[model samples]
Target: MSPNYKFQGWMGLDKDAAKGKMVWQEYTPKPFEETDIDIQITHCGICGSDLHVLRSGWSASLYPVCVGHEIVGVAVRVGSKAEGGIRVGDRVGVGAQSSSCLKPDCEQCSGGAENYCQNHQTGTYSSKYPDGSKSYGGYADYWRGPSHFVFKIPDALPSDVAAPMLCAGITAFSPLKRLGAGPGKRVGIVGVGGLGHFGILAAKALEVDKLVALSRTSSKKADALEMGATDFIATDEDEDWAAKHANSLDIIICTVDSPKMPLAKYLRLLRVGGTFVQVGAPEDRLPPFNILPLLAKDLKIAGSSVGSPAEIREMLDLFAKKGVHTWNNNVPLKDANKAILDMDAGKARYRFVLVNEKHVSQVERNEARENKL
Candidate 1:
């Protein structure tokens, strides 16, 4: 399973690299194994985590890091022992996770919660395999990783649109589904950025009774409504916004990471026995909030990480069935540095997907055939 192609990508050499200074260079990938697959990357979605890692926000990032997780491409090589029926030329994707301890005796792995397998969890980038080789990501010409973490992209989903779903879509989908967001539930999605946009779409696809898009201002009101939100709340415009929407929603998924966000007011928006799940990762600690609301209203506040492999498959199937369209702005792969800067500045309409023109002809051909059908 030796890689025939040289591993090359846009790498962040240091903290300053976050300021649109990534350089194109060749790098070595992890040692290939029978369970691995090599992907000729075509599209990679720019995620907030990429920026966080580049600037060493979460922690010290592995130097010369290639930071991208929501990746889609054509499989150029598939190991004989690779699971999931992956084959050469098949369009596939990799998410935030690359590997975990899948040993049968491990509780998380055996219980279908591999993403939470703390025993040996490895991120797609800035992580090390058990063999001590550094893992690279998909802001590059090719990606090499374990096939178990790779997924076959559905024909109904285009590469550019499908890229963000691996992280943003699933980040929103997992919590909504876990909290039972359907028919009778009123769901509120806080923040209308890349992650929150998918939250609205996922809740809508689940057929929740009401979908509320909450933002600091009304700038994204129209866009949210177009994405199936039943209502929009402008917190900044209304001084009594929280009071106005008090006890209105059964579940709220907070996608904003501001430490100073009005936590108490957000909790007040939930009905009795409601649940609030925080998915955004803030570098600073969340401001302390009163717990009286939780005790009085029987409210539950929690956090969710990315979805498991099984959950990802379920989300893809749901997207295919419901014709869910991701609001994406596609940028050429060479312009990734600029794209990251734009994303950091909140310029993306929803999500920023990097398209590698060299490998996108296959995707174009597929799109053309699907269009004719």
Candidate 2:
């Protein structure tokens, strides 16, 4: 299928773009193949990773990068060989991942862990395809990618709400589900921001016995409680906060990436045999912590990336079934630069999703009307 539309979006030509300098420009997308699908983006969520990449915080980002992964849009072009039964005009989404080697011999791919596929895993933006073409993101008018990474959006979930779920929601959902979060388990979500908010929502949906939200201050206390957190910990206000909650939770999902975070104290909040999963990516190395506590309690520390296609599908179904709602502020796609800056300044209520006025569908418009009622 040939692309009949031009690809254009807000591109960060250099590091200064992180400081609200991104320019609106037309860009070229990767060569489309029979397995590819083209989407006219309606909404794209502003993720912390976008800011990180804009400034090359994690690594030197590719020049002229269009950075966004939490993308929801209408499928305008579907290749004949595309999978997932995607069709033209279907509401769909794409996440942080764009491609991975789907070889039969690859253990990760065969085992349903394609997100961890070591061979040829490609990010949605600032990444290159095997053909040496750059993969553009959803911060623009359109996005083209392999259909394997694209997903059909559920009718029950609004596009603005579902956009962040593609990345932030799945990032939290995968770890909790994998670590056995459910009725009998207690879960603690550290850092109540974009990813942490989803962690609280997912833990609540999983029916955890106790859900605790830990943050530096009590600013997000009400918001966390409204999101179904049973307990809120103000780390800055309470001196004995860690001691008070000692051995309380079975799983702790740390979503903040500060090297100076009280790592050892956070470990102490875990019960015996508890697991602490680190999903936040910090540019600097994590601070050294005492290993004796880990050894004493037999605690385990692990890391999780975004979920696989199967897991993403499972999460979407769960969101629809459980009626999970996201706390998000919508910004115009044209003001993406300002939105990114606000996101970096911690001004987002929880998550910020960019709305492309030109591409919003009737269904999304209807969803907005219903929400107002």
Candidate 3:
């Protein structure tokens, strides 16, 4: 395969890109390496990070960055020394991470925690590789990078639904599964959006005794029930919602990134020794809360980033085995700007996937043409 592939996608030149003004053009990918795989992108999910990068919301973003991480595609090329069991033509996916230093001495890498790999944790976009090449993302026609972060997509899940799981789904599923959200445990999923929806589906698949969906209003009640929630709580509508559901859930996954969320009241809904995990990355500092509630109930407040590759594989397997599927709205990759805007406005039913149908069809055509040639 030639490195002559002309990479192209929506590029954010400045903060104004957040206002739906990304320009599409050809871009260069990192130089080829023996440990790389070139994925012909079929779908990429629009995440909050894409919005943040377009506007430089989270620190300084690399300009002209193609920001997106939830990627699903077919491996068109695989390097000889690439790891991760990748093969040419395999349907695969990449998550928030693209590359990491895999040295055995590295604490994070050696321990099967590549997501926390301290030394060379490079994001899929707006990041630089060890070779000083810019790392592009899946919002493009092709993505070339290390295979360490890539995993095969299960046959049961569609590309659109599987795409968001690479980011939003795993973000919630990891903490929920890690905290033991299975039989005999009551779980609550706050925010009923992409991440929270996955939390509800994952909890149900894990066979939890009871699953609850928590949102500011009861607007999501029907959707939550469809996603397998056994109960729903409208925090704003009910006067004493917290008191009424006091000590009800063993685990709570907060998917809402809003800084102004009612913290103490949410804590009140937890049972003794219950754990509250915040998976959403709020830009602002969290609201201050008294420690009395935590101390009294022996409760825990924690935060989780995306899962490790091993963990992602485990989650994918679980989803396959339990028939867990995501509720996703598909938008053409060309309409990414509109999709992101809708995501920002909270319009998506749960998750959004940018389908690169043209790219996928082109790849298939090219493959057939090359064989004929």
Give one digit per residue, the lDDT tens place, for model 2 in 41-145: 999999999999999998999999999999999898888899999998789999999999989999999888999998988899999888889888988999999
Q: Higher lDDT: candidate 2 or 3? A: 2
The true-versus-predicted C-alpha distance at residue 287 of model 2, in Å, is 1.4
Give me the displacement of residue 122 in model 2, in angstroms: 0.5
In candidate 1, what residue range of length 10 has the lowest lDDT sum? 1-10
Which portions of model 1 show Cα errors greater than 4 Å? 362-373
Clashes in model 1: which pairs?
Answer: none
TM-score of each: 0.97, 0.96, 0.95
Best by lDDT: 1
Q: What TM-score quantifies how close candidate 3 is to the native fold?
A: 0.95
